[model samples]
Target chain A: MSEKPTIEAYLKNIEEGHFKAYKCVDCGMIIAPPSGSCYGCGSSNMKWAEVSGKGKLVSFTVIHVAPDQFAEEAPYYVAIVELAEGTRVSARLLGFDPLKPEQVRLGINLKLDYEKGKSGATYLAFKPA
Target chain B: MPLNNTNIVSAAQTKFGALTGVTLREIFSEAVDKATIHAGIPKKDIQAAFIGSFIPEMLVHQGHTAPLLLDFAGLKGIPATRHEDACASGATALRAAIMAIESGLYDTVLVAGVEKMTSVSTSKVTEALAAAADDQFESSIGLTFPGVFAIAAVAHMQKYGTTEEDMALVAVKAHKNAATNPLAQFQKEITLEKAMTPRYVAWPLKLFDCSPISDGAAALVLTSNEKAKKYTDLPVKITGTGQASASMNLCDRSDLTSFSASVDASRQAYKMAGLKPKDMDFAVVHDCFTIAEIIASEDIGFFKPGEGAKAVRDGITALDGDKPINPMGGLKAVGHPVGATGVKQAVVIYRELIGDAGPNQVANHDTALMHNFGGTGATCVVNIMRRADL
Candidate 1:
């Protein structure tokens, strides 16, 4: 068992150039972006562990109309990436033209990465590996 | 198996649109007044109030809204509580009122839902609406409601070969139905060309594919079956209701093509009513986005999975079609004032069942279903209502 996985700690790890998810100590199931209880077997016993950051592009959307916070980054790709650990996470999808969604292919391999927003905050992102 | 306990005596709502300069209290009271007056019941008869307002705290800087709106509606000195489950806030409130009546705590109650969204900038409203999603995983990463649905739309398209044209047809149908709905926001029909040409709000979801941000309120008066007889001869009975929730984050869902909570809720509602999808005369489903309605059509079992769009293309969901849906235009053209939407669905169904839907009236109104979900299908509420005489 290690320090409980809080979103703050998860981001802190991301900011430090590491991607970690909660691995249920009981069932060995991975819970990404961290959760107190395991979705697999409903156990709260979990430990922080690093993931391979490898996954496939499951589904995606190009957001032309963004929220106020991300207005400056309009016309960006947001995608659901399934980590090789079998857990899915939503992240910024890069290395593709958002305007031409016809070219973006699903099931493309991707690797976990980080990007900086206009507000100088680091965020979890994914790019074609 | 039907819920013989509670009946809807009356339902009312302000025109769904950008009601500029209209305060929440005024619109809310207006709806309350219309419902009570239509039912011919004095406001004093409402034993308690359950109100729903999704993001007034962000949109209008108002909190503790249950008492504020209730006081303005002359429903003061009664026990009032507010319910919030994102966009399904109103249905949650309605469910609570139903349970309260069933529990014998109160014979008569009022349920209301409202939102004043157009008062703010579009970007601000978008930001406010995004709060409904999981902030850490979804909204915080720049996912808007349109974006969330777009993701689902893409998945549905991929798995079922549902084309963008299939989705555009939904918008066209919504506008056509809305043309005859007096209280709808957009009363003019749109061509498929117009729907297809709109810029992408989120890819696979065009601007026309989305519902507008509006301000409005809807209220319903409910009483036990015995008390309903004192009001109107044509009371609509709420025979079945089911509310269920799923993971707050879309990433947690195993499939993006359909919403599990909707299926679970509708199944529960159908079982309770002792009815099936074929028995429903019509439906008022949450069409927050065009794709949502298509997915909802399947989720409620009206159409098999991946067959909803085909049904739409075949005119099966039109006003005169075999299984009409959103005969009052739905959130698409009716305007989605978030919280008001769920309550408005029931209002539409009640009017249809009572033969008051005017030009949008369908041939059969024996029974209908209303499906409303909050956020990316995280919270879903399904209800079946029928004429009490049935």
Candidate 2:
């Protein structure tokens, strides 16, 4: 078994532009954002595995009313991206017109990217590949 | 025999809306007063208390609320506990109270849910509600409650050909039902054009699609069946109660079109009651968002998958429809006071079951179901109620 992946480490990797997920040592299933136990096999034995950072947009929403932290960045896109590793994660969908959701089609391929928020914090993001 | 050992002697709620200047303790005590008076039971008879209030510590700067609220209501010194499951907090408290009675621990207990949200700003309320979602995965990425349901609305629209108008129709029905409900927040019917005209809160979910942040509270007095006769002649038997959950994050879910927790919870309740969806005269589900109502209608077996939208369009879920849903305006028009909503759902159903619902009453109200969920379907509670004589 390899070292267990922590959210801090997973996020630090994303900040460094190297995205990774936790893979169950018993079932070889990829778990994103790190979990104590794998949902598939219920295994606590997991290791870090770098994902291809490529996925398709399963669903998306243009947030016009955001929480206070992201209030300045209203009218941004938040989407559920189905990673190529068969797991899904929520990330900002960049490179799209927020005002034109009619044109943003689902199932469109997207590659991993990052966006610096108003708080000067790095966030996981994606754009059209 | 069904699980009919426990009965609700009475239930009551404050008019849900932006109740300005009302403190948490005041509203909760008001609800408790109304319920105990209606039940014709002395406050001293209450053995314990289970209260539900979500985010009050943040919104009102008050925690350890169980005793505080109970003490204000003049029921001080009884064992009390606060239950929190985001929007489902009230129902979770009710479930706890019911179990306490069923376990032979208490003959009668008080169950109440309250939330004073209008005291805070909208953004602050939004941030507080976001706490219900997974902070690391969903909320940190900027997912508001409306955004969470908007994602589901988009997925359902894609797979079921459910148009935005169909979603708007739900708001229309909600407003229509609430028009006659004197206690409802939105008491006037809205045209389809009006419902669709509101600006987007999230893509595909307009301003009218989401439930409002309001201040209110609801209370119920539950007693064992043997002791129920001492209170009221029309006690409503709680035949079935079910609670289930799913992945907290929407991304972890395999499908967004329906909430599996509702399905599982309703199934458990139905089995316990020896009833089916068809047997339920109506349902008051958690319609925190318009799309959520559509999804819940199908999830609880009132309609097949992808059929809930059509049901709304056809007026099949209206107050006079074959299977009336949200006959008392629901959270959409009734105003969702977070913790109060779950208990309020039971309050509405209990009134309908006992023929106490005024102008908003449905023709067929012998049996009903109340479904309440917290945080994008992560926590769901369903309770089936029937007239005691039945």
Candidate 3:
């Protein structure tokens, strides 16, 4: 039995300015932000590896009405990015105006980035590579 | 699994428009009393209870609600349970009660779903509802329900050439039907131009496209097949029930145009009922947004993958169409009281199928299907019901 990795550790690595993902030792499936078991092979045997930090925008939405915590950040862009590893994750889309959603295109090449929120917590974001 | 003749003998719901000053428990009790009394069943006859609520605590600062609701409805001592699956909570509760009866654990069960959402500001309500999404991934960054579905709408448009005009047609149809539904939230008809011009909540998804923030309650009196005849001869037989869960994040899914949970759950439902989608005379789907209706139409196999929008455009889903969907105005106009939406669908279908939809009933009425969906298709509950004579 392998020791399960925590999300905290994965985020901590990101805090250290390194993008790390868990790859299934059995099937080579790369999962960002890690999981307890491999979706492809159900293998507990996993290893932490650095990601290429490259992805493409699959879908996105401009949240005009934000939550209370994100009120000042209203009209922000959030999108799902499909990474080079074939794993998808939701992150903030930077380097663009949130009010102008028509300008953003799907399948656009992007690179992994980070943004600090009002709470000073680091969040995953993507920008034009 | 096939429901073993667990039938809804009587179903009732309060008017689904905005109502103020009523506690959540009061709304629940009203629905339970109306349904059981209409079923001609004594309070003592209900052996168990199942309730569904979403963000009730956020709206009213109330929690541990099942007991209080059951007690208010005069069924305090019976074993009671609660179900929460985002917007599918109401149907989840009904499914649990049905299973309890089918498993021989109880002969009769009272199922209720209620949500009092109008009490708070829409911003706060939006925050509470965003809990349905993955906080770490989506909502934490301010992704609301409208945004998630809008992204799907955009994907559908990119792949299928579905236009904003096609989506607007869905809202037009919903409002046209809702104008006739006495209990609907929006009781006025809207033109295609109006739907198109409505302010945008998210790109490609406008105010007219989104289901309104509603507060309401719905309840059903269900009993086993053997005991059903004692309550009513016109019971709605729940022949099939299928529930499936999916990844909460839409990114995990391969396709953004359709909900895999809906496809999977409907497959299980069709298998259990010994029926096919073509056999459905009518259906009430989870049209939380205009684009959602189009996607749901295809996901449930009523239309082809991208043909759902075409079906909407061609008027194939209208009240007079070949396959009428959401004859009772659906969530778009009927009002989506998250927890209550699912059970309300059942109640409306049971009433409409038995020629009880008042002025809003469609022409077809033999076999019907009801779909309840939770958060971006993360969970879905699909059930096939038939009039007892059928």
Candidate 4:
């Protein structure tokens, strides 16, 4: 039998221009950037679903010594955002200038964006609301 | 409980920390010379070889280079094999030597680990080290080894209330231990004030809290128990060795306060050696980062979780403490030449067990443990050994 379309595949399909994730069938737990399995239940039987594309800014760090690939965007802000769906994801917390760790605070709404990649890898990002 | 089955008669090492112009073969040759001299054995005695290295492709652009290096080291015809398990390559090499001696396939075996990390740039070194983690899930997320350990530190602090002061104590003690160790990379001691004031490398981790990028090699001359007695009256025996691995991704675990692989491997080693943590007179646990050392102290059952840091602050982990650890400055002070760290730990254990560790030796030390972990605890090896003459 042919394998069913993965949750990541389904989310990437509908996320051609929009950011989205999934919710658990049992505990309503959310998996962000879309995952194939539920961490809560360990079930592969997950479904692609849409989120509010909004989250809370939980924590952040200013990566001054960026990786080689991310060197062009040196000293960028990487933050953990807890979506309205209650799942946390890491991304470049945009719409901020010369970010510092102390500047970030908990319970700040964050918005997600979907972007086409230069290397055929779809990208997801978040920005302060 | 007698691992009189296998013994290491001699050991040697190359100067660690950034050998700028040395070739891999040159490094191996230096190690070979030192081992032969220490063992008082001829080069012709090595009947087999086990070589350990990480990222030779990036550093030297060579694959299957062990046979060539062993040949150049004058062990051309012996069965030489390469062992790579990220940073645990040295312990793996030692394990291979032990197995060979125990199997009666080779009466004398040479186990060496060589890595030329300085041949690459700083960024390249970071990238190469990341290869120890899962590329698809961990590295793809731009998570470097420092970031991985940083996450663990955060989780441990959140769960166990470990403080920055606790982490600083680890660096303090390691530096204190390294100050008296001639072979240590940083032979100067730093006070807790200095360690606490350093520039941050990652959240809750500073530059001094981490092991320096080092280039070096280490080698051990393994002989059957019978042959070891002929070389030295106090050759250390291979009492117990155990290795275990855990999930490659840090996000895949239920708890981050302790390394599951370390706990499991230590349990196995202790059982095999017929001993417990309390039975150990001293130990050298992996301290790639200060927090790693603290967590290791707990995982090895030296302290309760979250209590390791307190123990350090309380002076319980000092060299004069009841359960001294990392008396040779550990990876924090001595430097961690990734592939060479495991064997170096063994060498430290050898020194202490023989009461040859001047100034740093625990009084009356008999049995000791050496714990080495690879890539954020994804792989761990713990060995327990006692004075062979005991």
Candidate 5:
């Protein structure tokens, strides 16, 4: 059997606009990539919460040399993001020609970007708002 | 002291280090031969068998090698099964054999652990081991086992004021013990000054803090007290065997300083043995990284949580100390051949209890424990033994 799509699908979703998510009604917990149930409250009480597609860049690491699968995108930044609703997420940060930690501010507003990979998977990416 | 319940009548191991001239199967055969000879028992006498192996396919492109190797070793039709739990594979297998005897499944069993790590490149080995971690989170971040342990070391220093010197002390003691162990990988003692000179594999963890990559095998024969008499007059009984598991992802943990798995497993073993950590004469802990030993000592109740680092600094865990740890050099110096490590640690304690540990023997040792941890403390098994009859 073949392996499941993981990081590949995630990145591809960022490249496309069809990125969907969910939020817990009771605890105000945001669920990235959407889920049938709330991971926080363990309740089935969830609703389709359309994100503003905006957040803050929490932290990032610039990979000078990427792995074989990501070699073409060498020198990219993988950042952990805190959404406007206070949920944290991880995604590839785009728009900066040359990524640097100093350039990536802690509270800088981030706008969502949709990206597509060679595998025909659409995913979510991020850029400075 | 004599064995408390199940006894280890005989123990043997391949010449550990970088095994260059033999395959895993051959190593197991030799170890089985030596163990049976030492116990003065025939192959037909072993009622059951357990084999421990990790990453055989990655190292040798072979799977389902355990039963086949047992058959090759002349135990053609015994109840044999393979055990896999990362570095704790061998120890867990031994614990299974002990439990089988204690539970009256079989009167006698054979336990063996083997790994042929030298056949693979260092990078491939690292990659294979990383699979034991949270592949989606940790490995995705390019965090190797050393890197995971490095984070723990940094957390220890940050939370408990553990210094680099404290970490180096563990390496120093492990090497000193290995200096006298013929089967140890780096059988030479190193000074604390040399250990502190860091060549970074990961931040806050130096090359010296890591255990050596090794290839080896170890085997032992286990039996009930009644049946043990048929083979040998002296047998080290398995007093207590315990195991525990935890969250695979570090991000899910509330605290990073101590492995809750080790704490629970050791507690179970101590309870089963009707003893406390304070009653132990000595121990052999999983020291895949120097920081791991320090943290594990505290988690297993040897010392107060934060005091283990201080204890190391004070020369309290040395072979001559009140509570010696890893007297057989540990994985740091003795080598971490994964599947073989847990069983090998048991062999060290069995020899010591039998007055056969040679130069590494602690003075007047009676009770001992072996801690085998799999992957950044995700899984753990603790076995307590004594030189007394049940």
Candidate 6:
């Protein structure tokens, strides 16, 4: 009952410095990037559920040729992080040299954060825990 | 490969490159006219049309392109539809014709794809093409197609020890094959050092590792089995057709090393054709990037999970190797017109099967496979075609 189970609501929370997830009210399942229906049982019943903001890196990329908005922010790392709530989200990876790709490891622990991009857009980001 | 009566009687394509003084209308009409003439049928004989177009609206300020393209082909009111699935739009449009024939809806159909990208600036084209990714999540975070595939490249390297050298080998092989294709965009071959030394588009992915943005058009004439023999002496039977989709976002996928869509589609296509990947004589997969070809080869069951990189490195996927791949140069060098790439892949294999591939012919290219992939592995279509004489 903290906030509506909408992506806008989820982003609002992230913008206000909190990483949120969606939990199925019926089956107690959790998912990220907010879905209209439950992935576990296809139930539309859902609510905003807070997560630990802790996860592990699954896969990642260092973007050199960015879109027009982020042209100045080339050579940034984007990663897929699995949360403790058993859901995954795409976020920017920070606190590591982008040129040294070999130093990055898979399945490493990361902590969630939020930042503003050159496009003046807020996005989810993460750092090595 | 099922025993259906759908066959490709004729196919044609405009040379893929920076074609000047040609409008989309001219490019599409040229391919249509050539295909119609080769089919030995008047344009009036065409019953329906399907077009694969990604961004006529964005690039040309055109919408409802199906009828417009149909009008250009002289088939104005015959139930035309334009399909859009990012890069897989060509195969998606091709599927409509196949379905129309399978359901007895139309005996003769025109399947075509066209894209004019060079007219716009490179930044405008980049913005337009980025529409294929997950706009809300992936693209919002500043990921381009090159960056998307770069992640896959790095993941493959980390998981299976795939080296950048192995990735460069794919580019080398692709250019070698393209040099033989007179219609290909980049007919000049490059060494591995040249390919590797180029400026990086994304980390671990150089400029040479990516498929070029091209302008081209291709058309195919399809007919029901009963009508195929009357049109052309050499008919390539579309024995198996399979399409599958995955998560829209790259991060949502459980595995980055392989695309589930390709695996599911190829498995279904193989099951329908009653043959396995090993039985295929050759293949043309979606090599949008060098790493993509490696992953696609593995995803299509042509090689083991991690062997795709090594396959290219060990000459296992060369033109004369045991499993020949991309003899028509693939998208790497043949040019990817985005919406037209998948259809061009089909046309290449079709030519190889009919013994019309001047000197690029393989010894055993009797049966072939073509993999058409859309954005970020979201949509994929795998097709198995066999020589009519077989």
Chain B of candidate 5 achieves a TM-score of: 0.97
**Which runs of model 2 end up more than 4 angstroms from their true locations?**
none
* Model 5 Cα lDDT, one tens digit per residue, B151-199: 5776677678887789899999999999998888898989989998856
lDDT of 1 by residue, B1-390 (tens): 778888899999999898977888998999999999765889989999999889899999999999999988898999999999999999999999989999999999999999999888987887788888888777877888899999999999999999899999999999999999889999999999999995999998998999998899999999998899899999999989999999888888899999999999999999999999999999999999999999999999999999999999999999999999999899999999998888999999999999999999999999999999998889999999999888
lDDT of 4 by residue, B230-294 (tens): 77888888788889999776645546678999999999888888888889888899999888998
Q: List the residue pairs that clash in candidate 6.
A: B1-B272, B1-B273, B1-B274
DockQ for the candidates, in order: 0.86, 0.84, 0.67, 0.22, 0.12, 0.73
lDDT of 4: 0.77
- Residue B325 displacement in candidate 4 (angstroms): 1.4
The 10-residue segment of model 6 chain A with minimum total lDDT is A1-10
Over 4 Å off in model 3, which ranges?
A1-4
Q: Residues A13-104, candidate 4, lDDT per residue (tens digit)?
A: 54475655666666667675455677788776655566788877654445555468755555555555677776776555676663345455
How many pairs of residues collide in each model?
0, 0, 0, 0, 22, 3
Itemize residue pairs with steric clashes in candidate 4: none
Q: For every candidate, what share of the true interface contacts is present?
A: 0.88, 0.80, 0.70, 0.06, 0.00, 0.67
lDDT of each: 0.91, 0.91, 0.87, 0.77, 0.78, 0.88
Writing each residue's lDDT as its tens digit, candidate 3 over A1-129 gives 244556777777666666678888889899865677888988887887778899999988777766778777767788889999899888888999866777888889999998777756677889999
Better of 4 and 6 by TM-score: 6
lDDT over C-alpha atoms for residue B239 of model 4: 84
Every model's TM-score on chain B = 0.99, 0.99, 0.98, 0.97, 0.97, 0.98
Return the lDDT, model 1, position B114. Answer: 94
Residue-level lDDT tens digits of model 2 in B71-168: 89999999999999999999999999878988899999999999999998877888788889899877887878899999999999999999899989
Docking class of 4: incorrect
Worst 10 residues of 1 chain B by lDDT: B135-144
